[model samples]
Target: MNPQQPIKVLLIDNHPLVLDGLKALLETYSHVEVVGTAGLARAGLEVALRTQPDVVLMDINMPQVNGIDAIELFQQQLPGIRVLMLSMHDSREYISTSVLRGARGYILKDVSTEEIVAAIEAVARGETYFSSGVSDVLMERKPDENATPLTIREQEVLRLLAAGQSNRDIGQALGISAATVETHRKNLKKKLGIATTAGLTRYVIEHGLN
Candidate 1:
């Protein structure tokens, strides 16, 4: 697909209302065209195979297969198909897992039409886009209690975490006890409002802090 041309988009979601709303909203954009829409993963695959759209706006949960699982398939069978996940969830596990599995973007269903359109265009251009719920936690400055930026040691721990380092390994590398490393880990979680290691990793990488 030419970068300058209107991007062909395919919508795959279980909710009829969502599909209808998306179709109607996208119809207003001259640079984007909704080529097809599907309510199930199987149907989505069929639509994709038929339409060969440049981008896919897919929901996480569908009838036959979830969007994350289907991402690899589209990458394999429908090469060059940029997928921007349309989900109501902004959980770190959900969003990060989708990106780790090759999804180009993830946006919540509550997103503004402009945000949705921006996400589609960005994803179609081979860039990554995360909704406010996800990006705000990482990119936006936090309040007073959370205002303090991570310390050098905390940043080191985060980089190691992004590198897949275990607590013991991080301790060894930092010349600190594993218990202290564990403490730093917990602090990291509290400060970042992140629970899973994957979430921390994603935050670190996305902010280029790793």
Candidate 2:
């Protein structure tokens, strides 16, 4: 995240040609460094741990662990690293899920190299960056209307939980006990009809609760 340092990048894509092309293109920029590349999300996770890159350029479709699912892994294991999804699909589900799982940005494969570089830099700086097309697609989705509304206390817990805080962490931040935090978490899931942490996070994001 230091301005003087070059942004270290790791590329993860199933296609060899895509990896090669991205590496070749990104290497042309002096501000960016290609740290490593992987053909799978698990392999990419290993490389990311080892290299500790500033940003990760990950494709959504791959064998074993797909990129959308892999985002949570990166978030849990390497929370400091920014993940920028590079995918061909512009589906709303994919974009929403990527953000829910803690991806910093989502960009299509067909975007210009300049845009890709911009996204990496933005995410590395702790900012979100979606391509113009991706942003447009996300803007079209409407919030669920029939969902139960959350109380003020529930909203606080949900926001902290979505920010990746543990029960103890949320409790300390909100001046509540861990047990209370857990109860709030359970109530949140029930009220939202969401089962997983990621689901709750997506709900918080979609509803602008965070």
Candidate 3:
């Protein structure tokens, strides 16, 4: 494992197109070699055990045996192999869970190619990496070190919205303009990973914030 040597890598994603895209993207780097790929967690673990890649680029959500739960399986077969999660989820719960499950880094799918390369390289080198927004979510200080901390304004908006208030009414109640209210609405949605009012309401009730 020379520092200057090209990194050996494996990719595990359910989508064939995504695997192709990642292989093509990774091949462009002389320092990165795509040793193997698999569309299933079991197959990927098997390939990983055989290929002995330095890093495993894993997708979080697969049809069966999600990447988070599979991290330990991979470790059992390949103890020192680092895993970098390539997921669309930026929520604190997912990121925290992945880290707890032994992911070395987490980056969103929307990240740029440069970022993707950087994350792979960093994680392969035994360093942690997170996309900018993912880092923001992780850096947010929870109430007691594990609580998901939403902004004060976002909480206010979520409470009012869960109470069946319109955006206009919420804005009026919060002393902010409707436009500002809309901005807060979008931010909270992104942060909480809830897109609809119904989903938000469910979240409100589930968390006992109602």
Candidate 4:
């Protein structure tokens, strides 16, 4: 990921129009290169392996293998390659599942072309990016009444963790050590009665912690 090199991108969507339109839109940018396109998740995986794209812009709805499930496949095969979900589905379940499955960012397909490019570039840089629509959905969820309240810093850590950030990345953003981030994570889990990272993410999304 040289600063000078254009960010390579792979587009995966079931609709041919969406794939073509996005590829055309992204190609106008000097910083982005549309390396390849696929209409299916398995095919996208093959293309991704061959092209070795810096970022993957994937749709949630596809034939046979959906994008949410495909996320883990990409992560398993291409460890450091960033996956940014671009889909029309904005449901919290879809978004949260994508995060749990290792998506770096989630954006609606209706977003502006520029915003899509921004999301791709941001994720390619190893930073999480969520569309305003996705953020709004997360914000509308109400916390459970009986849930224990968290400190401001703990809430910050929970929000970042739910947004698919690594402990090191969260620590860098909050000006804390990775150990401190882990401590906050443990505290959040203890307070929320959530054991796994995926459970914590689902709780944060359901409670509007974002």
Task: Find the 10 residues in a row with the least total lDDT in model 1.
Answer: 137-146
TM-score for each model = 0.68, 0.74, 0.66, 0.73
Task: Give me candidate 3's TM-score against the actual structure.
Answer: 0.66
How well is each residue in 1-210 modelled by candidate 1, as lDDT tens digits?
Answer: 697889999999999988999899999999999999999887888899998898899999876799988988888788767889988777767776776666777888888999999998888766778787877644433323645699999999988776556789999999999999999999988888777776776676576673
- Residue-level lDDT of model 4, residues 39-155, one tens digit each, is 999999999999999999999989899999999889889987799999888887898779877788899988999899989888888777889999776553343569878889998
**Alpha carbon RMSD to native, model 2:** 5.0
* Location of the lowest summed lDDT over 10 successive residues in candidate 2: 136-145
List candidate 4 stretches off by more than 4 Å: 140-187, 190-199, 202-210
Task: Please write out the lDDT profile of model 2 over residues 59-171, one tens digit for every residue.
Answer: 99999999988988888898666899999999878887787667878999899999999999988887778898887766633434686677898999988887667899889
Comparison by TM-score, 2 against 3, better one: 2
- Find the candidate with the highest TM-score and give its number: 2
After superposing candidate 1 on the true structure, give the runs of residues whose Cα lies further than 4 Å from its correct spot: 137-210
Give the alpha-carbon lDDT of every model. Answer: 0.82, 0.86, 0.81, 0.86
RMSD of model 1 against the true structure: 6.6
Off by over 4 Å in 2: 140-155, 161-210
